[model samples]
Target: MTSAILVSILMTLVAASTPILLAALGELVVEKSGVLNLGVEGMMLCGAVAGFAVAFSTGSTGLGLVAAAIAGIATAMVFAVLTLSLTANQVATGLALTIFGVGASSLIGAGFVGKTITRLGPVFPESLSGHPWLRAVFGHDIVVYLSLALVFGVGFFLRRTRAGLILRAVGENDASAHAIGYPVIAIRYGAIAFGGALAGLGGAYFSLALTPMWADRLTAGRGWIALALVVFAAWKPGRLLLGAYLFGAVMTLELQAKAAGVTWLAPELLATAPYLATIAVLTMMSLGRKTGRLDAPACLGKPFSAS
Candidate 1:
């Protein structure tokens, strides 16, 4: 491929990777706080529709993102109330959340189908964003930069900060954390809220930044892939970046294949490339986990209460 073509592909890959990385980073925090929310896909859907509707109506991508985050937090509260307060089964509750998100989004977005809006433009001006070499550094929208920044932020928060240390304490042993007056349940609620908000933002990225349109199920199964990516990275932020880019490359390859109309592979198979890679990565991680090498949070998925 020519340099220009390569640059274009790289740009697409970055765009594709950002949402997954954003969603996975949020989930990493959720898991680290000892909660497993499977409703990420649903939350993303809520965010997608909410963001699109607001942005499309108000002519402000920024407002749409805000609406998406609220929608996500609202949806996540359902899971938090059930799993945290009522102590529902985490697995079952999570599955239900995903189902609810799918149906609710469809209902909410029924009228939004086929609608289009202006795509989010680059953050930098033409002088930088349009330059041959500098374009790679400045050619993307704000969300792209935000996603990269969050990676470093999360790594720092989880490893360097004292609050991060406390959150870890709760995840490692909720009872112990509570005994120390850390308010275990409260910290978890905050984590879940943060996760939901990020998932929402990630979902909004699909409609506002990537496609700049409204469509039901627009996020497809990327939320699930994000969930899988957390496992693939063993819950490390740095590795999460690597894994998101890897999947991004897979998605880019699929897009290139479809664009070229390559007859060597079936079109349907190309579409499944990202999911297939997710499954393969998950399988490898599972096998390695058989030796107890996995670094999962100790209290993950376990219901906790102050009582």
Candidate 2:
């Protein structure tokens, strides 16, 4: 019985972590291009509202997901225009973008408050659902499996692909990349938009699948945690998977502790576990003296302009 319970708990952790994994993976690519986007929270909020609205209106989860991606990409285009094309400060522009996303999402979601929509059902084969081991591993929604696939996909692309090499080169030194005839601005814009679309998809997962309910501020800073995970993982996709699962496990454990009537743990402290873990991982990364080597993009947060 104890073993069964433990397995169930682990399964729950995997499910809870999928959204964070998806969003973090997108942000990982964005930062890899030497662009620091702080507007993930905003983009996610927009996706949440947009996805919920579309799902409610059309009664189609597929269309809702597509709309969410479009909304996120549209919002990201604003950031791309300001930071990448106009050479505005990445940090300030990202923050402003996030602020806009938050307000816009809230106002748009006002009518959606307290609304519930039909959720996307689990995507596994019925045969697998009853098999104990397979159920534990494969019975989640399609998004969970896709998130895992993305982790490996991004890792391989960054390490092996020619396009990935060019992206990395651009992030490392845009001036040098530009001198070599690479389209630095175009690369950044595309990467930023891709990141935004992925983040939006993550948000839609919450509204259309996880909770299937609308609420203001529903993301609750998962975006910030995703940002931290990029740094904690040393900008590597494989490590991002580990970091996301670890945070997800911590979050699940907190909820379990609360449910099991663990009196010694304060509710507030339990809620802080994921954030605390992020801070700890970041501190360790910084203290380990890896910034000069396997750390952030060389030009991260720096505005790039063609001379």
Candidate 3:
């Protein structure tokens, strides 16, 4: 491919990767706080719809993103109340949240089917964003740059800060953290809310940045991929960045293949590329786990109560 074509492909890869990275980063923090929320997909859909509706109505992608985050927090609060407050089964509640998200987004977005909006533009001026050599680095929208910054920020938070130690303490041993006077359930609620907000932003990237339109389940199954990506990265933020980009490259390849009309591979198989990679990555991680100490939070998926 020529240089321009290569730049286009790279740009596409970054755009495709940003949402997953954002979602996975949120989920990573949730898991680190000892919560295994399986409703990332559902939360994403809710955000997607809310973001689209607000953006379309007010003509502000910024406000749309805020709405998406609020909607995500609201949806996550539902999970938090059920799983943390009422002590419901985490896995089951998560599944139900996904189902609820699907129905709710569909209902809210029904009027928006086929509606279009202006895509979010890059933060930099056209002089840089449109520059031949600099566009690759600066051409991305605010969310893309934000996602990259978050990777480092999250890594620093988890590794360098006192609060990070406390959060990790909760995950490593909630009882101990509680005994030390830390509020276990409260911290978890915060983590869940944060996760929801990021998931919302990730979803909004679809409607506001990726396609700039509304569609039923526009996120498709990327939430699941993001989940698997957490495990694929062994729960490290830096590794998660690489994993997201790797998956992005795979997805980009699929689109490029279709555009090129390559007949060597079946179209159906090409379409399944991302999912197939998800499965493969998950399986490999599972096998790797058999030979190593588990890297997951010690209290992951376990219900906790002060009583």
TM-score of each: 0.97, 0.96, 0.98
**Whole-model alpha-carbon lDDT for candidate 3:** 0.94
Full-model lDDT for every candidate: 0.91, 0.87, 0.94
* lDDT tens digits by residue: candidate 2, 66-117: 9988999999999999988788888899899889988999999999998888
Off by over 4 Å in 3: 289-293
* Shift in Å, residue 263, candidate 1: 0.8
Per-model root-mean-square deviation over C-alphas:
1.2, 1.5, 1.1
lDDT of 1 by residue, 150-215 (tens): 999999999999999898899889999999899888898999999999999999999999998888
Ranking the candidates on lDDT from highest down gives 3, 1, 2
Model 3 TM-score relative to the real fold: 0.98
Higher-TM-score candidate among 1 and 2? Answer: 1
Winning model by lDDT: 3
lDDT of 1 at 189: 90
Q: List residue ranges in candidate 1 displaced over 4 A.
A: 288-290
Give candidate 3's error at residue 180 in angstroms.
1.0
lDDT: the better of candidates 1 and 2: 1
Q: Which pairs clash in model 1? A: none
